[model samples]
Target: MAKTIFITGASRGFGKIWAEAFLKRGDKVVATARNTTSLNDLVEQYGDAILPLQLDVNDRAAGFAAVKQAQQKFGSIDVLINNAGYGLFGTIEETSEQEARDQIETNVFGLLWLTQAVLPVMRQQGHGHIIQISSVLGVATLPVLGVYNASKFAVEGLSETLAAEVAGFGIKVTLVEPNGFSTDWAGASAAQSQTMPEYDGVKAAFQAGLTDDSFGKPEATTPAILKLVDAENPPLRLFLGKVALPWVKQVYANRLATWEEWADVATAAHGH
Candidate 1:
């Protein structure tokens, strides 16, 4: 049976690839991006199978409206892919207050609003899947990407809680942690705050590493995402890419070890 899927940020990157993969599998896809014009080629190519719409996830009303429109068009959304996030590369001090707020609004609050809008419908229908496009950075902290890391970390927390909350209602939430993939993600589309003078060297290195050649192909993640969509019992979290698994595993181990080592002091601080 072909399912109905609603995906955000479908103009490019993993969203675009996922949309194509679903369409190829004969599913109905309501694909949205901030600029619908960017999706003209896909609309022309896929016709009715892919319904392209203009959606700015940061706009709360628009988020609800998009969900309503998708429901009306496809009857019901069997899967919702919250893949509309961008990286904000900078040190904490380097990123402006507004820049940080914009990051949270787009990556965290926006996703939450969209999820909230869809949950009532999913709960009433008795079955649904929600996939959040997080990153390995969500599990581990790295230098110079604090804002992006924070956003993904929030996603990790939100998805985990949502999975537990919706499991009884026949809805499943999955978080996808992918390493750097070759997409327009690292280009001008990504938000990179101006570098603080003290961190010039690190900023240069970060920018150099993000250039086109350093990432894996976008297709690498599409198969895993599709599998999750059709899975009978999908995992709560999936680490995509060969490189991401080990990193996430190591981070988990390291976090546990650190917590254990600090347990005495941590307890002492609370006067326990």
Candidate 2:
């Protein structure tokens, strides 16, 4: 059965790869980017199977309009891939307030507004899947990328609540937490900050570890995503890349150990 998949940030990287994969599988795709011209290749190759739209996901109005256009063009939006987000690379002190807010505006808030716009269509149809592209740092912490981590953490929290609230309505929400991938995340697309000399050590370590082949390629991740979309009972959270599962497990272990060690303090705080 061919389903309609609506994807944001489809100009390049993960979004573009996913859009192409879906189209190849005979799915109708509503592919959106900040600049529609970037979708020309997809349009030329996929033809009518792909509807390319110009959209800045940060604007609520644009999100609504895009959803409306998808509905008009395809009759229903069966799946939504919230992939329009960027990372901000810097320590909190190195990052300006405006920079932090702009990061959130597109990453955290944009996902919400777009999901809000698409919720109605999914509700009316009584079935849909919302896939939020988060990151491994969403649950764990990394030095110098605090703001980016915060944004993805917000996505993590929001998607969990969305899934619980909409499960009764036959709607599903999945948060995709990916490890470092061979995308432009740390290169052209990431919003980099002025170097803070104090964080030089952290920066050096990160750069030294990130070899060319260290990052997972976009095509390698497509099969896992396809499986999720095809599953009858998809997970509420899906972590991509070989590095994600083990690292996240260690994070959870540390978190649980810390919480257990502080259980007495937490219970005492109740003052009962």
Candidate 3:
């Protein structure tokens, strides 16, 4: 059965890749981007299977309007993929207030607005899937990506809470945590803070850690995502690349050790 999927940030990267995949599979996709002109090729190729809408996800009112338009055209949105976010590259102290605010606005608030817009539509239909495009950094930290990490962490928390809140309505929420991908996310699409001399070494070390092998091909993810959405029961969180799980395991292990090491101190603070 073909589903009507609403995807944000469909102009490029994973969004564009996944949009085409869905369309090729005979599904209906309501694809959105900041500039509709960028979606012209997909619109021409896919014809009416794709509905190209110009949407800056940061605009709350526009998000709701887009949802309304999608609902009006497709009748029901079977899936809502929140993929409109960018990487903010900078250390904590080096990150400017405006940078932090813009990051949160696009990643956190933009997601919230769209999710809210779709909830009512989904609830009425009695079934829907919400896929949030988070990152591995949401669960663990990486140097020089403090603002980006924080934004994704917020997404993780919000989506998890939303999953619980909407399950009774037959709505499913899944957080798609992808590691490094061969996309413009860390390149052209990313926003960087002004360079600080003190954090140069940290930035260099971070850049050095990223090798060609670290990134997964964006096209390869289409099958995984298709299977995910079509499953009878989808996971609350899905890691897209090879590096995420093992790294997350180590992070959790370290967290567990630290908590255990401080268990006595925590118990003393409780003071029964």
Candidate 4:
């Protein structure tokens, strides 16, 4: 049976790859990007199996309109993939307030808008899946990418709650956490903030080390997404890539250690 899938940020990287993969599998895909023209090739190749639209995720109205259009064309959307987001790199002090807001706008609020826009339709249908393309940085953190990290962390928190909230309606929410890969994310899509001389060495070394960190192919993740779509019972969160598990585990261990160290004081404020 073929399902109708709607994906945001389909212009390139994982989004474009996944859209083509779904179409290849005989599924209907409503693929969207800020620049709709980028999807022209996919539409020309797949014809009716693919519907490409221009969507600026920061616009709530556009998100709603996109969902409405998908429903009108496909009857129902079995899956919604929120894959539109970018990375902002810089020291917190060096990043302007607007920069921080813009980072959150696309990476956090954009996701929220799209998710909210699709929720009603999914609920009405009684069964659907919402796949959130979060980052391993959401679980862990890096110095220069604080704002980006915060945005993904927000995705993690909201997705977990969303999964539990919609469980009764048969709406599944899964957060996909992937570590580094060969994607547009590290190229033109990424924003570099004004440099802070204090952090020059750190930034330079990080940039140099970036070359060897490719853990997997961004398109290879399409299989994982497909698996989740077909899963009768899916996990609330999935960590992808060779480094995802170890990196996440280390972050958890640090958290546990801190919590244990402060357990007595942390619990002292409240009296039973």
Candidate 5:
């Protein structure tokens, strides 16, 4: 049976690839981006199978409206892919307060609003899949990607709770953690704060190593995602790429180690 999928940030990158993959599999896609103009090619290619709409997930009303329109058009959305997010590269001190807020608005709050908008419908229907496009950074924190890391870390927690909350309602939530992929993720459109003088050497090294570090391919994870979408008992988390797996494992281990090491101190403050 072909499913109807609603995907955000479908104008480019992994979102666009996923849209195309779903269409190729005979599924109907209600794809959205901030502007639908660039999606004209997809519209021409897939015809009615691909319904491109303008959406900024941060706008709660707009998010709700998009879901409503998709439901009306496709009867109901079988899958919702929250893939509308950008990378924010900068140190904590270097990034402006507004910049950090914008990162949260787009990456975390937008996802939350959209999920809320669609949950009622999914709960009523008693079946739906929600896929969150998180990053390996969501599991681990790097030097300059603090804001992006924070948003993803929040997503990790959000997705876990959502999965437990909706399991009884026959809805499933999966977090997709992909590592550095060869996408336009670090392109001119990426948000970057000015390099602080104290971190000049570190920033220079990051810039020089950018190309070499980005090794994963977008298509590499598409198959895993499609499998998850089709699986009857999908995993709560899907970590893509070999490189990402190790890093994520390391992050998890580190977190566990830290908690264990500080357990006595942490419990001391509780006054049990």
Candidate 6:
């Protein structure tokens, strides 16, 4: 059966690729971007199979309105790809107040609003899947990406809670955590703070850790995403790219060891 997929940030990168993949496979797509004109080619090619809407996900009203338009056109939304977010590059000390706030507004609140908007519709339908585009930074941290890490961490927590809360309503939530990808995510779409002299060394070390092979190709993710949404039982969390799982595994193992190392102190602090 053909599914109706609503995607945010569909103008380029992974979102655009996934949208085209879905449309090519005979699914109806509601493709949204800040500038709908960027989607003109998809509209031209897919015609009635695609609905291109202009949406700034940070605007709560606009998000709900977009959902309404999607439902009106497609009858029901089977899947929602919450892919509208960008990375903010800076160390915690170098990050500005406004940059931090802007990152949260789009990544956390914008996703929250759209998830809330679709809940009722999915509830009525009794089945829906919500996919949040998070990052490997959500689980692990790196220098010069403090604000971006924080934003993705917020997304991780929010989406995990959402998964549990909406399970009863037949709503499935998945957090797609990708490591570095050769997308505009780290290029044109990224927001960067002015560099601080003190952090120059830290920044260089961070850059030195990355290699040409670190990033996965954006288009290569199409098949993985397609299979993810098609699963009869999708996971609550899915990691994209070859590097994501190995990195996360090491990070998690260290966390577990540290927690166990301090388990006695933690227990004592919770005295009955």
Best by lDDT: 3
TM-score between model 3 and native:
0.99
What TM-score would every model get versus the actual structure?
0.93, 0.97, 0.99, 0.96, 0.94, 0.98
Best first by lDDT, ranked:
3, 6, 2, 4, 5, 1
Number of clashes recorded per candidate: 0, 0, 0, 0, 0, 0
lDDT of residue 152 for candidate 3: 97
RMSD of each: 2.0, 1.1, 0.7, 1.4, 1.7, 0.8
Off by over 4 Å in 2: 211-213
Superposed model 1: Cα runs more than 4 Å off? 204-214, 267-272
Q: What is the Å distance of residue 163 in model 5 from its true position?
A: 1.1
**lDDT against true structure, model 1:** 0.88
Error of 6 at 123 (Å): 0.3
What is the RMSD, in Å, between candidate 4 and the native fold over all Cα? Answer: 1.4
Q: Which runs of model 3 end up more than 4 angstroms from their true locations? A: none
Model 5, position 77, has a per-residue lDDT of: 89
lDDT of 4 by residue, 1-272 (tens): 89999999999988999899999999999999989898988888999888899989999998999999999999999999999999998988899999999999999999999999999999999999999999899889877899999999999999999999999999999999998988878779999899879998878877776655656887778788889889999888898788789877888999999999999998996876
* Model 5 residue 263 CA deviation in Å: 3.6
On residues 15-73, what C-alpha lDDT tens digit does candidate 2 reach at each position?
99999999999999999998989889889998999999999988899899999999999
Q: Provide the global lDDT of candidate 3 against the true structure.
A: 0.95
lDDT of 6 by residue, 1-272 (tens): 89999999999999999999999999999999999888898888999999999999999999999999999999999999999999899889888899999999999999899999999999999999999999999999998988888889999999999999999999999999999999999899999998889998998999999998999999999999999999989998888899989888898999999999999999999986
The per-model lDDT (C-alpha) reads: 0.88, 0.92, 0.95, 0.91, 0.90, 0.93
Candidate 2 vs candidate 4: which has greater TM-score? 2
